[model samples]
Target: MPITARQLLQIFPNAGPVAGVFVPALNEAMARFKIEGRLRVASFLAQVGHESGQLRTVVENLNYSAEGLVKTWPNRFSRVSAAAVARKPEQIANIVYASRMGNGPAVTGDGWKYRGRGLIQVTGWVNYQACGSALGLDLLTKPELLEQPGYAALSAAWYWSKHGLNELSDAGHFLDIGSIINTGKTGTAPHGAAERKALYDRALQVLE
Candidate 1:
């Protein structure tokens, strides 16, 4: 069941500029990642839609206000700490992402260098290295490549396939899938689980 550019646009109307690129990338990725089943296709497209905001943004938004920081990363940005780094995406990325996700300490610049990118927001040095190796892109040297339309779709599909999301989709364990995709209280009812599920159903309507 190969998806067409027209069908893709039916679901994602704003994918105008990159439709020529995205449709082919997605079709290629489907074959590479074995996204064979209907559920897998719907789930994959739905998650990518939610994460990338209907294919509008490939990079993560790091510009956080003090209040946003406190709400988003309370542990990292206490009231006092949030104020200091408010509206500073680079500084916030350095502080909050420091020494984690295979990143170096705050002073090493690994945080900003490997900030979240691609359709699924691949974060950290380890992720870049692995996804890069899988895609043969040398992302460690040119992390910005993830922002490209083809690479963004490929990287996200790689991540989805690597994580065995197809199995989850087959088993109808969407909540478990959400847990893996995001950090939320429950695997099934995470922060954006409802929206993800809704989109999944919508995509299924089109894909089926």
Candidate 2:
């Protein structure tokens, strides 16, 4: 059966003020991308719900005015070893100042550039531009709009279309969505692919 707007709201009851904004957009995106079937809908919603905290954390720290990706400071290897890190007072102050000033995530070779945003957690400037182009929106110019529900929906649909979601069997690689959203890695992970697949299967069964 096809997923409906009511189902989404039921799945995420406490969506708050953004419920009005997200529901219609989600319906539109699902339809636009021809994402039919209850399983796919449930999986997509589950991933987005987990990522955005049911739409409350859409713009990170409620900083819709935030221009671009703002990630934590890098460690000695210049890698984002941890998602949330304890920062020194000066570092915390600098991050705040830079974010307000629209400095965005520093374009280093480091992997920190890909934080999270949009419905699918669109990351990196290249991805932002690609998704924006796919949806006929200039994300590079107005990157902050990814935080907006409407734009976020469009970007996610674009990603789903581009990533060939319709081609893969939902049950075969259910963790693909989670990997895509969380780590920006697609398909399966090298070390824990089997474990991830098991978890995905369990979640899908419960959702269904």
Q: lDDT (CA) for every model shown?
A: 0.86, 0.58
For each of the candidates, give the backbone clash count. Answer: 1, 0
| Model 2 alpha-carbon drift over 4 Å, by segment | 1-5, 61-115, 169-171, 186-208
TM-score of 2: 0.64
By summed lDDT, which 10 consecutive residues of candidate 2 come out lowest?
A: 62-71
**How would you encode candidate 1's per-residue C-alpha lDDT over 1-208 as one tens digit per residue?**
6789887877777667666668887888888889877899888888888898888899989999999999988888799999998989999999888999899999998899999999889999999999999999999999999999889989988998888889989998888877888863344466678888888888888987
Evaluate model 2: give its lDDT: 0.58
Candidate 1: stretches off by over 4 Å: 14-16, 184-188
- How far does residue 127 in candidate 1 sit from its true spot (Å)? 0.9
List TM-scores for all candidates, in order.
Answer: 0.93, 0.64
Measured with C-alpha atoms, the lDDT of residue 155 in candidate 1 is 94
